[model samples]
Target: MKKLLILVFLTLPMIAFAQTKPYLSIADAERITAAAEAKAKAEGWNVVIAILDDGGHLISLKRMDGVQIGSIDVAQAKAKSAVYFKRSTKIFEDVMKGEGGSRIATLPNAVGVEGGLPIFKDGIIVGSIGISGVTSAQDGIIAEAGVKGY
Candidate 1:
């Protein structure tokens, strides 16, 4: 029993350390935003991009000139939904189009829109990015570019 207790105590810290998740850094967030911005600029689209950490905390936000002011909140909501739900916002948008999908609207902070994607590192979600201001499909394209940057 003494040996077993010592082993358990010795391994506890390793277990805790192994469970620590990777997080999005400020530099990574900035890189993602820059990539998304480049895509938007190349396509001549004015948009708002929002990046969130694994905990759904805002890391970065960019609203291009001529983008609607309302898109700021929408972009953040999309990013938050992606991080909190661990999936693309497009899934919710698609579900909302189906019958009985109105229930999705009841979920707090859920945005039924495209352009939100969970950023992955080594198959684990590290963060998310959301874009707004252009068409949903276009926003999705920009978001994809941002995630690819990371």
Candidate 2:
């Protein structure tokens, strides 16, 4: 029993260290925002773009000319949901399309929208991006362009 306890204690630190997540640099955030904005413009979709670090803190935001004011908060919320949940908002939206779909709506901080995506580098999620002021599919496309910046 003493040996087992010692082994458990030794592994606890490893477990904690493994939980560490990467953060997005300011330059990277800027690149992502630019890419998202470019895609929105290329498609002629006026949109708001938001980027958030892995901890769900906003890093950068862009509001294209003519975008609705309400899209600013919605874009940030979608980015937060992506980073906080460590998955694309599309996944949550898909889950809501089938049986028991309503259960996903109960999850705290889960936006379940289609415009958010996690940004990954070296197979680790470093941040996320979200776009709004367009159709969900178009917003998702723009967000994907932003994620590719990393």
All models: lDDT?
0.93, 0.89
Among these predicted structures, which one has the highest TM-score?
1
List model 1 lDDT by residue over 19-86, tens digit each: 56677889999999999999999999999999998888889999999999999999999999998899
Q: Candidate 2 — what's its lDDT?
A: 0.89
State the TM-score for model 1.
0.86
Off by over 4 Å in 1: 1-19
lDDT of 2 at 70: 96
Tens digits of per-residue lDDT for model 2 on 2-89? Answer: 9999999999999988845566899999988888888888988999999888888888988999999999999998898998888999
Which pairs of residues have clashing backbones in candidate 1?
A: none
